[model samples]
Target: GALVYQYPRRTICKSGTSMRMECQAVGFQATSVAWYRQSPQKTFELIALSTVNSAIKYEQNFTQEKFPISHPNLSFSSMTVLNAYLEDRGLYLCGAREAGDAEQFFGPGTRLTVL
Candidate 1:
């Protein structure tokens, strides 16, 4: 069984600031970590995916410049939402997957609030 734990379940920051969130994988080796954002009234958007020993892949509209990711090992990952704004408000989720796993284990997610 794989489980992902995300920290700072909810947070609020003034506009033009940055916020960092962490994810930890337990009960299995996480070969890949995917970051997603579920904005209000919209479906989940794939932010980025980080694989061990490989480059971090960012989806369209997302970049390392704005959402930097760090996957140092098999069980840990982190990402930062740089210069947060109203458009960045959403539920940031972390999904960790092990080798050969069909599905990823998702954390509760960190909700972002910008004012």
Candidate 2:
């Protein structure tokens, strides 16, 4: 079975601070990790997609400068939200996908709270 795990299910940070989280892929090779943000209002946004052996692609509203991702190998990945603000508050998810699957298996996610 394929699974993605994320640490610190909830986090609270000062308005001007930053937070770093991790993602782990288990039971399968995670060729790609897609990061998304779910807001309290239920809006969703695709942040970025990090694929092994390929260039990382970030969505229009997101940039590497703001949400930098790291894919060290086929089974793990991570990302950071720098200079956290009110707008940065949300549920950050990590979706892991293998080579043949069009759908991704998502982690429970880290709930971010900004003061």
CA lDDT of each prediction against the hidden true structure: 0.94, 0.91
lDDT of 1: 0.94
Candidate closest to the true structure, highest TM-score: 1
lDDT of 2 by residue, 24-100 (tens): 99998899889999998887699998899898999998999989899989988989999999999999999998874
Model 2, residue 101: displacement in angstroms? 4.0
List, residue by residue over 1-115, the lDDT tens digit for candidate 1: 7789999899999999999999999998889999999999999999998999999999999999999999999889999999999999999999998864558899999999999
**What number of clashing residue pairs does each candidate have, in the order they appear?**
0, 0
Quickly count the clashes in candidate 1.
0
Best by lDDT: 1
Cα lDDT over the full model 2: 0.91
